[model samples]
Target: MNEYLTSLDRPIEAVRYAGLTVKLLSTGDGTEVIHHTLQEGSRWSMQPQEGWTASESIFITSGSLKVTVDEETKVLSTGDVVSASPIKQGLVFLALEETEFIYISSQPVFQFFSEIVRKNQELAIEVALKDGYTAEHCKRIMQMSMLIGERMELSPGDMCTLNYASYLHDVGKIMIPKSILLKEGPLSEEEWEEMKRHCTYGKELLEATDSPYMRASGTIVEQHHERFDGKGYPNGLQRDEISPLAYIVSVVDAFDAMTTDRPYRKAMSVENAIEELNENAGTMFHPEVVKIFIDLIPEWSKMKQGV
Candidate 1:
């Protein structure tokens, strides 16, 4: 094997989160060096797993960073170095501006992070297969959510959260009984209550990963059912109390659900779905999101028609 590798060499692994890219630069002798590029306004947080005690060191190579270790926070520019104490409570790194840094830590720690991303990907596939509509519905929701997110000019971090949350929002449905999920008639009141538990299940599912991105995504999963008028379930959180990403997911998910065939009903026409959304605007859905989504329907239809 070659003793040295160049930038052209393929990364051992790479992952993107919250507008940041993490690349495994090198690993050997129980240590790994990871390169991180954080887009301006991006932030990453790490909380040590129980019994974790290895320290990690970071060196900034470009741009500016705001780093918090325990109770202390510091701003660092190019060429600055900071070392985190042995794995303890919250350690946060934020890019005040676009920043590049190298982090050195035990290879096992890096491996753990890599494994979590891989597991999440695998679980997503499993969740998508639990029902026929889930895969297609999630895909459409992701696309529509991105369109609305672009229209809203969301920040990069927000877009990242929105992207992941849209796909994983219904993941908890995997746990629902197949009979209830595929029921062709109206659900019993008891079945409906059981169905509503999916949001909480989804949140718990994502929270197990202990990833900041997953945590953010979990928040959306939990609140996506909330209404603008504060009548929705799980938590009845009112307007603006819900995460903006959750609002986007909620709007897009509803649209996708209306336009897609369900076991209980055929798909609604786009015009009818739009009417339904309009009727519920500001009560069940965010008014601005509803407006933007309604405005985009024409373009979506045009594209579908190959215009």
Candidate 2:
């Protein structure tokens, strides 16, 4: 007698596995069992896709499968299981007259992945906002930085580099201790030291991620704290020793900090902030950077209005 079971009786539900119809026998939180049967000549194409935050396993029940992860490719025979992190997207090709396999995965895997990517994007936005305080502030600083980079006759690529550098100048502050960052009173010397560490901290954070734009950003972070006359922390290298990109970031960063309201002080007027930067030229900021920055303030304000 042929043996066939009803879905309710066997707990096997229908599903699609790598474009093939399959049956999912059961599913629970972070775990599921699926059975798939493949026809002869059926093929599977896998991409480097990983779930946001779960693990996946595919076990061959009959026939075989060809799997490729990164640049490494392998073939798995019947009863063979492949395991990988949920975030890893791999390639799979099917082989055999009738192939069967059990695939397992986390229950909320897709939800978890979506949530993480959403939050990570938000974090990127938040980091940008926190650096400039307001959208307008970021706009003004970016315009000003771009103007200075342009005046220097930098290549289009360098100008793009400068813009991104200014945008993420404070990306390291994500690692700052909240107590110190949010404090309203004058920071103790130790707290001040902690604040300075954001530059180093930001570089390290960017490097740890998969961002390709972070290479130049790493230098900006390292030099954003450096003073024109050389009394900077983490590294005191003075004068032309500081990178040009670092100089641009330093000028933009200081301008935004002074002209924007913070917990400890009211914002200085734009005019006063500009004057202050001019006064510190050659002493605290690169004189050339200060000059170009001053020229861009009006145009920067126009962009700020939109933000």
lDDT of each: 0.72, 0.63
Residue range 9-44, candidate 2, lDDT tens digits = 553444432225555566556475656676543443
Listed per model in order, the count of residue pairs whose N, CA or C atoms clash below 3 Å is 0, 7
Candidate 1 collision pairs: none
Q: Give the TM-score of candidate 1.
A: 0.60
Model 2 spans > 4 angstroms off: 1-132
**What is the Cα-based TM-score of model 2?**
0.56
Taking all chains together, each candidate's TM-score versus the true structure is: 0.60, 0.56
Estimate, for each residue in 83-160, the C-alpha lDDT of model 1 and write its tens digit.
755655544566899999988876345564566545545445554433334444565576677678779977555665
Point out the worst 10-residue segment of candidate 1 by lDDT: 127-136
